[model samples]
Target: MSAYDVARHFADSWGLVFLFGVFLFAVGRALRPSARDEYEHARTVVLRDEEPGK
Candidate 1:
């Protein structure tokens, strides 16, 4: 095989791997629950009841 053909093959193989990685990352992010959800669910507690002006 010519040098050009060899280089092209390598590039194509690596490119497919890179694309696969990106696709997996996108899918994982879509399926995962975010931290914002947890914070929103946490119960709020007031440590100090003092007046705001004081």
Candidate 2:
């Protein structure tokens, strides 16, 4: 087999597994309880008031 064939096989198999693992980790982190405050702050940061003049 050639380099192209080897690369294609890895991409078609292990690449998918790596991407799925990353997706699961991201989803888990987002849903975890400790992240609730961070998410809430992000959701309302735009509505918060700030002092004028630097």
Candidate 3:
């Protein structure tokens, strides 16, 4: 089969479903931005070494 045939075959199979699901998931996330805030939290501590108690 040629490149065109392979492309067309993929478009008709799982490709379309995968694209549709990704699009819906993106929209759903946009509609509920709050759901992602927990992921935005960061917990980190930075310490610097210094000469014995000045």
Give me the candidate number with maximum lDDT: 2
What are the per-residue Cα lDDT tens digits for candidate 2 across 1-54?
Answer: 999999999999899999999999999999999999999999998897887663
Candidate 3 lDDT, 1-54, residue by residue in tens = 999999999889989899999999988886687855544442221244556665
Q: What ranges in model 1 sit over 4 Å off?
A: 1-7, 35-54
Ranked by TM-score, top first: 2, 3, 1
Give per-model TM-scores.
0.45, 0.84, 0.46
User: How does residue 43 of candidate 1 score in lDDT?
Assistant: 34
Task: Using lDDT as the measure, name the better of candidate 1 and candidate 3.
Answer: 1
Relative to the true structure, candidate 3 has a C-alpha RMSD (angstroms) of: 7.8
Q: Which is the leading candidate under TM-score? A: 2
Residues 1-54 of candidate 1 have per-residue lDDT tens digits of 999999999989898998999999988866677855654545342455668877
Global lDDT for candidate 2? 0.96
TM-score pick, better of 2 and 3? 2
Tell me how far the alpha carbon of residue 47 in candidate 3 is from the true structure, in angstroms, after superposition.
47
- What local lDDT score does residue 15 receive in model 3, on the 0 to 100 scale? 91
**Alpha-carbon error at 5 in model 1, in Å?**
4.6
